[model samples]
Target: MIVKKTDNGLVMDFPALPYHKIEWSPQLQALNLKQPCVIAPYWCDRLGTPSIKARQGGRRQGELLCEIKGNRVLLYGSCHLYLKGTIYLP
Candidate 1:
């Protein structure tokens, strides 16, 4: 992954396929608790829609509604996304 330090924070770049699942490490989670971040797709081969969901007690909660099309990212739920991003909590 290529990470760039920005004035606001950091921008990370990585290649991913459809249905790719990204899990956060414990250390990373401890660093950014209740902090807001942005995720966006860059130079993707195809368009994809991603959803973020919170989990507790080994059960998955409802999916945070979102829509991604072209270069626009729309978040309808309490979750956040830029181009196409999702967050899963355990």
Candidate 2:
């Protein structure tokens, strides 16, 4: 996985996968949380198959939604692919 800051926000790059799941950690959740950000994935499919299994928050495409809540931030996504409840962030 590769993460880089762009003019718009942060972008994440991941190898195309047949199936994948990911979750953001506390440390990762703290990046620029106060502002609206977009985490977009690069190269997210294999022969049109989705890299991730999330239905929302763009997780199905290897992305996630980040928002500020209290002192920390929240990274939310429901990934259902290959295995249940399996998630990896970066």
Candidate 3:
């Protein structure tokens, strides 16, 4: 993963493949759900179901745009796994 510091927060660039899952530790998951969380997928303008449900054939790339404000964490990006949007923290 390539992490780049930005004025808002950080941008993480990582390789992603179809059906690839990004799992978080139990402790982190608990801490993250302490606040309101929202998830928004990229490429929503595209037709058909979300990428998470679609079958990806080859290696694809995506990014994670992360921003923090006070106690909230906002994440938005695109990938085969379709993990994008806002997440709250305790």
Question: Number of clashing residue pairs in every model?
Answer: 0, 1, 0
Count residue pairs with overlapping backbones in model 2: 1
lDDT of candidate 2 over 1-90, digit per residue (tens): 454556855444433322233354322332323222222222222223122221122333434454444343355554444445758899
Query: Root-mean-square deviation of each candidate, in angstroms?
Result: 15.6, 14.2, 14.4
Which pairs of residues collide in candidate 3? Answer: none
Whichever of 2 and 3 has more lDDT, that candidate is 2
Whole-model alpha-carbon lDDT for candidate 3: 0.34
Error of 3 at 31 (Å): 14
Alpha carbon lDDT of each predicted model: 0.32, 0.36, 0.34
lDDT by residue (tens digit), candidate 1, 3-81: 4455844333333222224443322231234211234333122223243221111122221223346555443333333
TM for every model, in the order presented, reads: 0.22, 0.26, 0.28
Candidate 1: residue 73 lDDT (0-100): 46
lDDT (Cα) of model 2: 0.36
Question: In candidate 2, what residue range of length 10 has the lowest lDDT sum?
Answer: 46-55
Record all residue pairs in model 1 with backbone atoms less than 3 Å apart, i.e. clashing: none
For candidate 3, give the lDDT of residue 59.
35
Off by over 4 Å in 2: 12-61, 81-90
lDDT of 3 by residue, 1-81 (tens): 343455854333333232335454322332244311232133212222132221112233323443344445554444333
